[model samples]
Target: MGEFLIDLKVNKNYIWVYFIAFYTLWCIRELWLNLYLDSIDSVPGAVTSAIIKIIIWVIPVILLVIIMEKRNPFSYLGLLYNVKNGLKWIGWASLVLLFYSILNITLLKNSIDFQLELREWLNVVLLVGITEEIVFRGFLLRKLMDSFRFWIANAITALLFVSIHFPIWFYKGQFEFPYIFSSILTVFVLGIIFGFIYKKSKSLWSVIIIHSLYNLLVSLFY
Candidate 1:
């Protein structure tokens, strides 16, 4: 019982530490990008963002796990792809996103663009998924699950996910009234779904693919 209490306390500390470090870096990144994005063109902007995400999201955790814990960070961060039903869950996940894309294209009559910019491909299609899944599902949600049930951990993680987007929404001038509410709700639901997919597939790459694909489709048709 004493050891269990100690473990719980440690888990809570980890969550708080990660939350503080990540949010601090995330806010700095947002501010830096806001300044840089207006002055620079798309390619360099995307490059800068990608580099920052690595620094902010991926590298610190890797270093910490190696230096402090002396454990291979790969599996802890859900970098493995050898799980059973990986492809099956990926297909199931993609189906939901594909349906959204199709509905937007056909029923909503949204215009579609097949040709994509290099920045869009790099930033949204690739890095966004990889970095975000690594941070949210791989690290945060998994850590939370150490203390809480899967759904409870996921809900907390999803709430944090929604909170992080507030900076962007406010910066974009959409953080007002019903739009902000609806947008938050949508993101929260998506976070929950992605968490579910991650849990079911036991593969970070599965969520990464679907997340990237969803963004790509939205970029084209939405």
Candidate 2:
């Protein structure tokens, strides 16, 4: 029992540590980008700003991980893996995403309005799609898998993925429970799919590409 308690404590500590580090990094990135945009006369759309910020922020984080953890940023790219298998995985994931896009369009017709502009489309592809996959799938998911079982890691990361979006409700100043719930459910499903792909292929780039394409399709079709 004592050993179990110790393990639980350790797990909790790691989760909190990872969350705090990521959140701090994100906050700093946002602040810097906002300030930079303010200094400039011609600014891009919110999506463009978000993508630019993520790119600017992720570089240093990747470098830090490489230096401190002695880990390769591209380790999850799976260049050493079988090419045919990788393509198969990507194809399967893309089909799943295509189906989800159709469902999203059918269910949330109005939600499409939130991402209409070209800049917004770009943002969804970069910030929401690629950057998010890197953080959740690439960093947090990988780190969690190191300590916990696969299912546990996926569940926890999926929950965190939903929780991160809670701020949207606060920003809107409306509860909108149904909408939020649906969004969370969608994110959880996507998380599971992406997590499964990551485990199967051990390639972050594979999941990242799938994620980016999925978001692009959703943005375009929906």
lDDT of 2 by residue, 161-197 (tens): 7766655444444338666677778878888888888
Flag regions of model 2 displaced more than 4 Å: 1-15, 24-48, 55-57, 76-84, 99-116, 172-175
Best model per TM-score: 1
For model 1, the stretches where C-alpha displacement exceeds 4 angstroms are: 1-8, 67-69, 81-84
lDDT of 1 by residue, 66-170 (tens): 664467889777776645566787788678877887788789999999788766788768888888888889888887887789999999999998988887776
**Candidate 2, pairs of clashing residues:** none
Candidate 2 differs from the real structure by a C-alpha RMSD in angstroms, to one decimal, of: 5.5
Q: Show how many residue pairs clash in every candidate, following the order shown.
A: 0, 0
